[model samples]
Target: LRETRSYTWGLVIPDLTNFGFASIARSLEAHCREAGIQLLIACSEDDPALEQRVVDNLISRQVDGLIVASSGHSDDIYARIHDRLPVVQLDRHIGESRLPMVISDACKATAELVRDMASECGAEIYYFGGLLDLSPSRHRLAGYELGLHRAGLEADPARVRHRDYQPSSGYQLMAELVAELGAPPRGLFTASFTLLEGV
Candidate 1:
């Protein structure tokens, strides 16, 4: 059998300050300790250049595997690493890399939740989403639209806002919506917990 103690894995994440990512890191650390493996982790702060740098550093360290929560498209970097060692993507993924991924089906789940809200509220539904460029954000927005369609409601472009997945952006978007409509929508969906906190 392969010696567990001889194995080390590199984990690269966008931001550890985000509660969800921090929790995943903590759980992975615990699991690694139990499995007698060394874990090396890096935070990219949601910058693609920093993410690449961290990945390069990990590659130099000769880790056996890599787990990345990509900040943006880095298929080339990941493809290079995949040729050397196994790579698994977590959460967000680079475009069309075909890497093994573990990501939440936020799209379907969010759609269902929005549908339920719309059914109960019997009013227009608004979506407050994250960065439009990010896959998760795009998925959630698509889900929101699908949910509205399923609920027999038209998706109004004016009622949708895509912003950074930050509390400040959420607050600002919500403020703008209220200023324009004079009241909040009866049904509202926020893509992230941080954004929800802002709302």
Candidate 2:
């Protein structure tokens, strides 16, 4: 009897409806094809239980590796699978696992970008951010504050708004900001592309 080799990887992300995630999936798929590996993709829609189910399904399929853009759950679902196969965390991480991870330097970059925008605008700047519960959103908000401080500008509570990372939330928040300020700020920084579209 001969054993067949498995060269398949599993990827679990929040949602492909977001262009960013879709682009990542496309790139991963292309890379896998070039390397003669099969790619299995799943969307968790930012739900913890859903993510777990997806991971379990991937494990049952006997994937060579797993990549997760985590849902910030505290459970050790990924850890349990670690001994069977390699696991890599992407973007966000689970509560306190020491799993290998690939995360962006969003904080420093965001701060620099905001500083440049403020310099160009020469007026008050406003931040339209995502839900505070998420790590990325929290980091970006910290960056926004750091940028204002570095630019010698004070943080204004009225100029900072947090909402779901959705276009409708962005639109509604922008409308409220406009009504409150009577005009758009000279500089507006949105945390996500979908939110930017609404603004």
- RMSD (CA, Å), each prediction: 2.4, 1.9
lDDT of 2: 0.84
Candidate 2 has a TM-score of: 0.91
lDDT of 1 by residue, 108-163 (tens): 99878888888887547888888787788888998988888788888889878887
Error of model 2, residue 40, in angstroms: 1.4
Displacement of residue 80 (Cα, Å) in model 1 is: 1.1
Q: Candidate 2: which pairs clash?
A: none
Off by over 4 Å in 1: 1-6
lDDT of 2 at 134: 73
Residue 54 local lDDT, model 1:
92
Q: Report the Cα lDDT for residue 70, model 1.
A: 89
Error of 1 at 4 (Å): 12
lDDT of 1 at 85: 88
What does the lDDT read for residue 150 in candidate 2?
A: 81
